[model samples]
Target: MQLSVTLIIIIVTTLVSISGFSSQKIIDDLIFYPPAVTQQRQWWRFFTCGLIHADFGHLILNMYALYIFGVEVERAFVSIFGKYGNLVYLLMYVSALIVCLLPTYRKHKNNYYYRSLGASGAVSAVVFCFILLFPLRKLGLVFFPVMIPGFIFGTLYLIVSTILERRSSDRINHSAHIWGAIYGIVFLIVAANFFSTYPVLQSFVEDVKGWLASF
Candidate 1:
């Protein structure tokens, strides 16, 4: 099999997450702990936290989402940005790890108890980027019976994520999902302006409008 960057990311993330399951040290060192970043200046945690996950289910869900969305987004980036596509793709993933958690870090930097791990934020970034490029594409949850157009899914996702972030006390970082998705769309627009002649934003709007008109 030709090893694309998306495949390599999935493989590396899976291996690291599995290794972390056997070694608490791996989890402790890599998991996002705001206190560590604030007190000890372990800024690398912003990036490394994405390399480990909390459990098998967390790892699988994240990597599975990444695998599905990342390949298409990567391919689109390559077609748009040409030789620099891979670099831009890597930047989107890594930056999403840090940018998506900025709010959490600010709020909990002194809360020694706050901790999180997983690549869900980065995966969200990839998924949103794909949606931006293909707004009319159908997307559905694995267990959900209904499939919806990508733009509608994106809107619903943002609403649900915002609600979950505010009202839910679950350990999941819904904030990251919200911010990561926004970052993905904004990053694509910015990069597209600089790197390619493709009317990224216009195309997205036209695609969504065309889809709406069809209905």
Candidate 2:
């Protein structure tokens, strides 16, 4: 069996996150600390922050989600973009890490107490990309007992993320979730239009219609 890029990412992230559990320095240096980025110019945190997670639960949830969706998204990209697919996949993930946090950075760039660490942003990007290709697929959250269509799930997710982002009542980076998903859909549309002959939007409509007709 061949090792996939998705598996490779999961292994590396799990190792780094576990190591960070013992080494506070690792977390501090790698965590997305806006003040550090703004004052000391430590820009790497934008990407490195995704390597460490807050706890075992956080790590597991993000990694599991990433693995489930990322593998399919990677495969789909290869089919769509051919030789440049891997590069595009990498670009989307890496860019999502930074782009998803831009809102947080702007709002808290001077706040010394603000810090976030995890792969949730990048994972959201992968999941949404998968959703775009498989809009009619069934999906269900662990806590949410009912299975729903992928596109419907994505829509509800964005709405919830937006609400949580505005509330700002918890430590979770809801903004990252919202923006990462947007980036994923936008990336797919732009990439397909410019680099491939795939009828992404048309296909999406047909898939939705097919799903609707089934009911």
Candidate 3:
């Protein structure tokens, strides 16, 4: 199922790119960016923005992460939710976008020219979900080139994104990533509470507690 979904994402992205539909342009034209406001507002842009990527490199990177982490998260979700797994995935993706847009909207409501593109928020959702589902797994950092356990990595990621949100002016949506991670963590906890069969998430919470205690 994971492989199938990954292939579908790649195919859809590639087809969209080949059709001359730039993801960045889509984001610029639609999504809830402050700068995108015009006399004629297109509300559908909010959902379409995530499907668009700035370039091939951007698309490839995001798709790769989606394929890598998304599959595992999907499997775990299916194991727990059974028939409701797809619904959870859909909700997580949409929730990430909503959370991502709010902070930008709050900060730039008056500017009406703020723009952002890419699927970083949704990608963060998958990455963080993976971390929660597999807290003991080691994650390799691209910058540091080292592997760290999932819980530590997830915590560090949240912290780094939060810190960068305050200090950086880079194009990357660090705030969206941080917020998406928070959403992922919260979603998992809430879902676990409601669905006791999701041992993976339950164990993850326990592992996180144990990791915290070790400090």
Candidate 4:
């Protein structure tokens, strides 16, 4: 059996992230250091940084989220784009790692102290894309008893991420999450329009409308 792009990403990211846990050099080289890119022109860090993570928890959470949603998203892409689905999916994931971090790069390009390493941005892109494709799908929290639709969860996520990003109280890069999600939605819409004749936005709207009508 052939390995899906999602599984391949998980494997590669997991191995590199685990290696970085013990090797500072590995993290130093792969991590997104704005100064490094600004000074040394190591722009590859934008995409390579996703291969390494801050820690085990960070790696696991991102990979798990990607696995949970990426497979479905891949299938959806295949359905929409035919033979080129896997390629498109791969491009989206890699490009998201860069696009999601562009704002951070601009803000910290000269700040030597700023460094980030994780796949949260790309994972958020995949999760948000899934939510866009299935807005009415039920989403549940770990400790919460109530389950809400995907769109509601996405909205709440964006709101909380925005507030936290504005506060700048923690090291978490919430800005990346916000941009990645928006990029995911836009990527799908544009890809569909350019590569296929599918009316993706129209279909999403119809799905949402049908779900609302049922209430």
Candidate 5:
């Protein structure tokens, strides 16, 4: 957990510094949306945009959430998948990004001017993984300070994202966050069931279950 958290912090800080050093205008182009049909085209921006942030506050808030949620998820992954845990996490992160971007890319193929940024997609992966691993656990919102079941929080987040996506001027990339959560929940459920039936995987899972039971 400590190692994973440290690596994430280092990666986020490095990306933030790179964004600051890049031309100010370049930051706008790299933000999760392609440029207008009239502007110069850059296909790699889809992946690079996620590495930049709108501000220090934005980066810190996202990183904080990632740190809080990602550590537990990594532990769960390692308990279930052993040495392959990091690979699974990486795949989930990349898959969520691609899945979230595909629809936007397809819809704005001509205009290519829509834009987004931040670590919301990766954060969503961690959040939803927590929801999956500990669905019955309680969580409290920072703003509301109201305690709620993890499953309820996860469901409400998805609903809110869907509603927010319809609004025209909303700056938040709620859709990506929602889809990323879905990807994490589905991936873990499927992987857990598939691995539970295998000899080695089942042994690891049983050991994890025993460890959890002891707690």
Candidate 6:
């Protein structure tokens, strides 16, 4: 079976994440330490850090979300972009890793104790990209069991993430999530405009408008 780009990424991330669980050196080397980037100029940490996770639960959630949204996003990109479909998808995922970390790097460039590891930023980019593609699509929480429009869900997610980021009470980088999601939307809109001539933002608005008319 030919593995898709999404599956390939998941396989590599899972293997590396599992290894990170057993080896502190692996984590230390691959994990995002802003000081490493600022002082040592280890720029690759911006991207490599996303290949490992803090734990199995974190790994699973990020990869699961990636698979759920990535498959569809890949297909959509193909439909809109023709031969460059997979290429654009890959670019978005990889660039999202770096783009999503820029703010974090700025904030923690000298915070020697600051370290982050996970694919959350890239995965958030994928999820938000999918949300833009299908604004009317219904999303349901794992616990709440109530289905809501993708745009609405995305809105709530950004709001909650912003609030949590302000609190700064957790190890998770909520700021990365916020920036990742914003980058996702912007990336898709810009890519569509320049590469495919598709009015993605307009399409999203039309989809939402149609959904609103149904009520």
The lDDT of each candidate is: 0.91, 0.92, 0.72, 0.93, 0.69, 0.93
- Specify the poorest-scoring 10-residue window by lDDT in model 3: 17-26
Superposed Cα deviation of residue 176, candidate 3 (Å): 0.7
- Per-residue lDDT of model 3, residues 1-215, tens digit only: 34545456556655764443534454455455654443345545555667676677887888888888987887777777777776777677777777766777567656765666667787788888888888978998677889989888888888888888898778777877887777877786787678646665668778888877998
Off by over 4 Å in 4: none
| Residues forming the 10-long window of minimal summed lDDT in candidate 5 | 196-205
Estimate the TM-score for candidate 6: 0.98
For model 4, how does the per-residue alpha-carbon lDDT over 1-215 read when each residue is reduced to its tens digit? 99999999999999999998999999988999999899899999999999998878888888989999999999999999999999999999999999999999999999989998899998989999999889989997777857898988999999999999999999999999999999999999999999999888888788888888997
Alpha-carbon TM-score of each model against the true structure? 0.97, 0.96, 0.83, 0.97, 0.78, 0.98
Tens digits of per-residue lDDT, candidate 5, 30-93, equal 5666444225566666666667787778777777787778778877787877787777776776
The sequence of per-residue lDDT tens digits that candidate 2 reaches over residues 1-215 is 97777888899999999999999999988999999999999999999999999999999999999989999999999899998887889899989989999988999999998899999998999999988999988999888879998999999999999999889999899999998899888889899999999978788889999888988
Q: Which portions of model 2 show Cα errors greater than 4 Å?
A: 213-215
Q: Judged by lDDT against the true structure, how good is candidate 6?
A: 0.93
Off by over 4 Å in 1: none
- Give residue 128's error in model 4 in angstroms: 1.0
In model 4, residue pairs whose N, Cα or C atoms come closer than 3 Å (at least 3 residues apart or on different chains), thus clashing, are none
Q: Which of the two candidates, 2 or 6, achieves a greater lDDT against the reference?
A: 6
Better of 2 and 5 by lDDT: 2
Q: Go through the candidates in order and give the clash count of each.
A: 0, 0, 4, 0, 2, 0
Return the lDDT, model 5, position 52.
77
